[model samples]
Target: ADAQITSAKIISLDAGKITTGSLDAARISAGSLTADKLAANTITADSGVIADAAITSAKIASLDASKITAGILDAARIDVGSITVDKLHALAKNLVNNYSRTSDLTGWTATDGSIVTDATLSAPVHRVTTTTNRQILSDYFEVDPSKTYKVTLSIKCDSADGTRYFGLHAIDKDGTSISVIPFTVSSRTFGGASSNFYFWSKGGATGGWLNLEAYILGRYIDNQSDVPEGKVVTSHCRMPANCHRIRLRYLNYGTAGTARTSDHFSPTVTAVDSGAIRAENVIAGLLQSVTGNSWISLDNGQFSFGNGALAWNGSSLSAQGTFEAVSGTYLAKLDAGAVKLSNSGVELGYFSIQTAGPTGPWITAAAGASKINLAKLVGTGLYTAYQIDWGTTGGTSATHRFWGTVTLNENALYSGAIDCGAIAADGVVSCWRVEPHLDNNDRCGTTTKRWQAVHALEGYFNKLTIGSNTCWAAGSMSLTTASWASVSFGKTFPSAPRVFGQYTHDFTGDIGMLKIRNITTTGFQATIGGSGFSGIAANWFAILV
Candidate 1:
């Protein structure tokens, strides 16, 4: 009748029905009650619990400060969030090996000077009793060539001596001084004057040593008051690179017997935190020659050289094998040392080549309204096509325009179509050919005569007469008596002219019948004798065929 449990039999019990007293410890097998089989909040200290060593992170659901005892969690067991910048900085390693002078001067070397531990100053001091300058160098050190380092040092003068010059020098592997930062002290005061000096240098193979030097002046002491007591003086130098050595040097420039002292030489070398290695495709050195298609762009400008092509910034776009415009079109090109402009592209209208000789420029143009128009456009107005100007001086304002052919060498004007209002020539003879024709005159019963009028120096006349001998004659003569007078008509009529006539104004009588006796082409004779004619003046006559 009682509830019976069998081996391998599964039974479900009420939440509060099961009790520890109901089960026997000897009958319960080891590891028989799993975590899931246990009821919540059932396992307390008063009841029963697992062993302390048996409880792990997997066994514990969560934990708080109250659950964890003090000093139980170490740095490894603590969360990283609990750590702070101050703690990390406290644990940082100093890159400087001998930052403090507490140790002996084992890694330092003094040139022309001696470095000794001074008990009075509680630091290492470098002393130079000689008038000559001395230097102290440190042991060998290494540096990353691509890194930048800051070197700092402190200098203090124990005795007020002559003017002193101290400097920090960076020495290359070949013992060449690459850089120096100098500190000058004009005069040292009685009390020690300490100065903190700092310098920067980019690390490389050549920059292997950091050195310190001092120059002591001699013989120029005006008084003992100006001289400084030589005792414990110190210098401290610090740099980021693993340096070869620190050097302390003394320079004697003046009289002898001048002593110098320096102490507390501590140096700090720190590397600058530049986030990442900046690598660039920069052309190093003085690029004498470049061979492939490579471009480097910086700021707003771009430079490229390759395949016989070059470009500068964005002003030029195309770079096949030469310089070109943005549209892949060439305006000019340089090939094999010769420069040429495009002929089929944009045309250059006018060009000029000036040289020492008589060679001229070669200009070519396409077929069209191609021409070279030279003009000075002052304002909006029409201008003449061609204007030839002449002047005796620079300011002479005389110009001539020719619409037809004008030969400059021969001084000739062809086409014979001159619109000159008046003409003045310096020739011995000036000729004019005129077509004999009247306006609106028909050829019917009208003579269309053609003649050439010539003016010679012998006379001036408005009308010309040509005789059968081809002699030209023109004149107006006056007669005084009826005697036969030689009449000068410039040229005589041929056969005394079959028709002759005479007219007189001063004579009132018949003027007698005028007669022509001599008949020649060069000259003629005329006589007037009828009654009542005493003299004749202003006589006009003509002998016509």
Candidate 2:
């Protein structure tokens, strides 16, 4: 690259149409160009000398493009202030009605029958002229003159005692007044003259009702202070104007002159506008509907509904569902899910320890020992009159047994007997029976203190069963006792002793040994048999530690 220095100032240059008075055309070679010789304007496109090309506007820079094809840049960047007022007219327009111009005094308060401004009355008192105490029956209301409004007043009192009377009065904004005759009069005898009170005069006959409520009590009768009268009632009244005060008086007749004038007999007034009252009613109606069309609550302990329904008492919510508690006993638990006991898929109600016994018929844990006497064991026919005992024996080697009739009831085997008892034994103890193993009348030798084993005498009879008749006399035995030498179930005949099994006495000494021998021709060797049985002999020593 070659560099060049210039002393003169260069104003402007156009690269597209290059023109340099100082540089000769021969200096700008066809293929040789230096950056120093180039003008400030850069070239944007290549000057091709080859093929035909279509350079669309989209291919050009935005600066060289038309205003309509400027893409996102053509849109206004700051549109907030750019929008005309006409386009924002809807959003800026006021949707709520202007309340100041309408002068809606429907529920607004007024002084007497006239509208009142910011004026207020101080001692605009009532003057009653009568020999007996009399109430200022009129000229009590005053309202702002600028607004038309209405008010509600509720009055309630005990029966009048001939000395008390109520009157109505109206006071205008102009300080003018008008009075009404005594509306209520009564004697002190019948609970004092008081009546439930409500009034509607605001609409004159068209506007909605004004709601008001009050409770008046006479100290003398209703046992109250201040008011001195025990009469309370809530009443609603609608008036066309606002109210300031009400005067009450007690009239005492004849020479007694026991009448008392109430300091302020005016029933309290609650002023409201018609629109607001309507809105409040609408809200109350909605609440009632959502609350299962129940009673609607209003001010002054009053409740009402669109259906003219009144609530005189309160109610409780109804129960929605029911449930049950599971039943159980010691060392037991109900399955997490329900387990069917009968046909019904009821949840498990009880869990108890497993026991073997009859559900009914025989008494439980029958008393006495269950004995199978060899003499009573018959060879054939039905054998009845058997006994079963569930009694506990108090002895070093206690044994329990049970037995009953040995009969086969149809295809089903019915064995009705009391629960067997526990037995206690030690060493080599053998047991033999005259009947079969299935015979209900079976007795067993006590191995443990609490064993319900079965056994019987020899020769007399045998146990019978639908299946193979278990010859009780000849059968195997188990080494139930921890220490046992040997045992033989059936009586060992002289020719050959039927030794089904045997057990080893795991200890020394005869402290836990047992021996039952010396049988005549009718007697035979009857001992327990099992793989663990050992030392099977007449004089064998069976030991248990």
Best by lDDT: 1
Candidate 1: where is the Cα deviation over 4 Å?
1-24, 28-53, 59-82, 89-148, 154-159, 162-267, 272-545
Residue-wise lDDT of candidate 2 within 150-189, one digit each (tens)?
A: 2323222222333322223344445444332111212322
Off by over 4 Å in 2: 1-130, 133-135, 140-162, 167-231, 237-261, 265-270, 273-545
TM-score of each: 0.21, 0.18
Candidate 1 vs. truth: CA RMSD?
A: 24.3
Question: For model 2, what is the alpha-carbon lDDT of residue 71?
Answer: 52
Q: How close is candidate 2 to the true structure, as a TM-score?
A: 0.18
